[model samples]
Target chain A: MSPRQFDQRHPHPRPDDDSAPPPAGSGAQARDTEVDSLLEEIDDVLETNAESFVRGFVQKGGQ
Target chain B: MGVVTVRRVMGIETEYGLLGVGNPAANPMVMSAQLITAYANEGMPGSARARWDYQDEDPLRDARGFRLDRAEADPSLLTDDPQRPAPEGDLHRVTLRRRPGPQPEPATVANVILPNGARYYVDHAHPEYSSPEVTTPRDAVLWDRAGEQVLLRSSRLLAQIAGMPEIALYKNNTDGKGASYGTHENYLVERAVPFEDIVAALTPFLVTRPVICGAGRVGRGQRSEAGGYQLSQRADFIEAEVGLETTLRRPIINTRDEPHAESSRYRRLHVIVGDANQLEVSTYLKVGTTALLLWLLERRGLPMELAALRLADPVRAAQEVSHDLTLTRRLDLEDGRRMTALEIQRTYCEVLTEAVQHAAGGEAAAPDPAAEQTADVLARWADVLTRLGDDPASCAREVEWVAKLRVLEAMRRRDGLGWDAPRLAALDLQWSDLRPERSIYSRLVAADAVERLVSEDEVAAAVLHPPQDTRAYFRGEAVRRYPGAVAAASWDAIIFDIDGAPALQRVPMTDPLRGTRAHVGELLDAHPDPGTLLATLTARPPGPQT
Candidate 1:
């Protein structure tokens, strides 16, 4: 095999436009807000169950 | 979605724990070399007579398309002289960086390439084994575990030779002191993708990945941070976001540009954030998911929704997340929002699940092996995170940290011991003991309390052979059949000393997937001798130009 065979590191060269990742900038900023909002809800649940959370930490793992 | 087209090369390099057996004052460097010698005498693969070619090793090369000044590279390497007198105390106290007389001849530096296509050698006081490249995550698991078996067998062999079983090996990163070794993973990525894109998309995923795969540690901190039990052992040691150094100022995204394959065609993603896992599932997912994420990053990058899930401060986040036993500690995301590591990981999981569904279609179809493995990893990753979300204790049997914690926590409850109890620390260290008779992980496996993926037979076979689908085949076969005449081997090629030949013949394995068993098995069967094999390879036009 030639070096050219391994040289193609750009992953897949052809990506269907429709399946490509979302556009950056405004689109990214907007998506970030939604993800952050979703995260806020989960953080609230974590806070409510704070006692169980602390217990889980030490009892679960480190070694 | 286009027929699941992905198969990235994966490999691991680990520094095994070395102990001074029988003699407490025994020098570790001397003991380590003895272990290698014992294994070599036992006829283990990659004998000292067989060498490792360092023609292409450039640790100063960075993934960001540039090379660091050679002087800036860490000089803490395996430059020690075995014949030299040991320092008065603490052999390591003598800074290896000091110019110690004239540099030892490069030929004197010891290296062995095992028949399994792995490299076993001393890396400054530590015995490191770098596994051969494999195509699948499962293969990665098999090969990494194979390294453990090699070390374990060597440990036993040393015991028999020295007449004492005092030398026990542990697959741990730290000595519970201020020092840290590495359980480093490497993945081949498309070099066309900008380095910035990889760092941006992978930093948070890598930081939080330990939640699932972390080998739980006993005491907290390394060098700087204070003590506390946490999810990962190596987390506290990391100090940078991007850099070429590994020993000092460790980076989350290592910049070591040693691709091991063709340089321009491949940029190895040297991952150092992960823990050395005990559970099979933990290691499988640790490698499997990372390969999937790398595939996605190379192809399309993370979706906008997932891309913005970055940590505001990665170094601080990695430290807090490790000690956050609660696994719910709030981390500042780049988007000015506070979230737990679990939630951030869950975000990536959710996006990946969608990608899997889209690629697999309505009925979970993986057109290729990579897609199939990626699909399996996503399912397991999602389940693990969900369990970690509700009750981490529920997933104790599957995740490495949780399984170890289950065993440790039980002892705590039964014996009325605190987390800092002497017994607890002892138990923690025993979990990583390489001896099956002493390893907590081994006990767990025997009792069927934890998941087991790779079997003992496969691991034993892997010890004596190399992967059939990569250049490792040629490397391993040549060494296995001709241990003496095989002059030296490297990831990219092997140099064979053909008897009566004009010059030492070199075979370039530029392509990681080529020169595999399917490609070279016939040639190997046809020629039992190195001279004839070299002649065949040279006469053939199918392989890379020598």
Candidate 2:
């Protein structure tokens, strides 16, 4: 019923190490490789004419 | 009835972005109608393309206790009337002539109530698929994904035709131009709750919900005029805090109060602020968390602290929260306190968690399936909020905006391009392409880049059948078994015209919880014919109902 009761009954679980920087070791390197490969896949399928495709995709307003 | 959980009658309506490939000038009205016709004729051959019954619809009736004058109302708000093209127009006649098979009448093809109990029709210039009513968030995601399958199959069917232009469907909100469509969420709330209570309690929650469920966008403005990434696609288009208009002066909390059920007991909360999400967890938590809050509101009224957390300017707060990519932007509350979007969301989650525990008498174990689902939603909500506070990149698998931002950032890094790059906007549009081959989201799912809650089999089954727990089962079964006898159907009634009946037999399903498979399964089987079914239903003595 009140914020005081909420704090006592269920303590908020704000992550303790909130300001820890993002990992910059092998994990970051591995993620980079993954993104590179995903971008490669996207390149194969992305529309060749980006400007026209993006420009031509007009739609009538809807609810 | 004992304790309110997250389980309630809910549905999702998605207005898919349609485009004619290689033909920029194609009429969307005709193309949208053709897409529906192609699906009903070819995708679902034997099923009846029932006309949408507009007898119960009243779109101009506002939930804030007044109805707008019909003349002053926007033309798009006139949904009760049939939207059809000219009878002998060139588009209609040419489309009819090109088809090689026995085609449905152009008027009838505009709307088809599927065997899955969903409505596939053209609203405005977009092809919309309204999922059948379901009780849980999981089923909501299932039927919503079933709609994606419906679009995919319909597009495939149209592709096989020789001369028909290949129409591509995007499960997104905007065309990146000035126009923005919608993906609306509907929740059934008790009529006793005041409209002011809903606005006061739910505004901050909706303003901050983008942190959890936003389908990310590549541009900052409605017309993509500004070059920056935002958390939500529909956020910039929202210009009002509350209104009855949908197409113009879009609102955060829509006041359209046309409850398709018993009006005295319920009001369907027509939510229009959400983006069309492709991620399952986003859709799941989007519906789940909101339902839990409504349950709290219905059972115990708005908690005092929640009312005090109202934003100073909700309309401005909505856009600020969307544009803040850091997820740390502080919003001003009416009490002169500042809270980040994550903080406000966590407050709601914590309160609901305590309420659920109290409902179960402090027992850790769930008492029922519904409670168990609520527990799951709370746990996911807590985990996502914690991760968002600590490191947003960790939620790439669960949160849609994070997942999409990861992809866009990677593309930006690889090409050495800014957010204004045409390729980035193109990729944003392609992220929601319904085709698996071209969709970036699909590729993420395939590569285990994103998390999934429902299986493909579950979504596929939902496409062919309705959930067994709601009245949709009765509606879906009637349409599937006796397609010929069903003249029209709506959310609350089904009109049956038998071969030798005296007149059209109307079956009123005013209650959303009634007409389940358990209530009418044996009856449906015993009376295979519509005449016998109607006779037995009418002959039964009326009893006291829930």
Estimate the TM-score of every prediction.
0.82, 0.91
All predictions: root-mean-square deviation over Cα?
13.0, 7.7
- Alpha carbon lDDT of residue B454, candidate 1? 68
Q: Estimate, for each residue in B351-402, the C-alpha lDDT of model 1 and write its tens digit.
A: 7777756765666463666666776777788888876876676565568887
- Model 1: number of backbone collisions: 8
DockQ of 2: 0.28
Among these predicted structures, which one has the highest DockQ?
2
Q: Which residue pairs in candidate 1 collide?
A: A7-B265, A9-B190, A57-B325, A62-B216, A62-B217, A63-B216, A63-B217, B220-B228
Worst 10 residues of 2 chain B by lDDT: B90-99
Candidate 2: stretches off by over 4 Å = A1-29, B1-4, B82-104, B362-367, B541-546
Candidate 2 Cα RMSD after full superposition onto the native fold (Å): 7.7
Q: What is the C-alpha interface RMSD of model 2?
A: 9.1
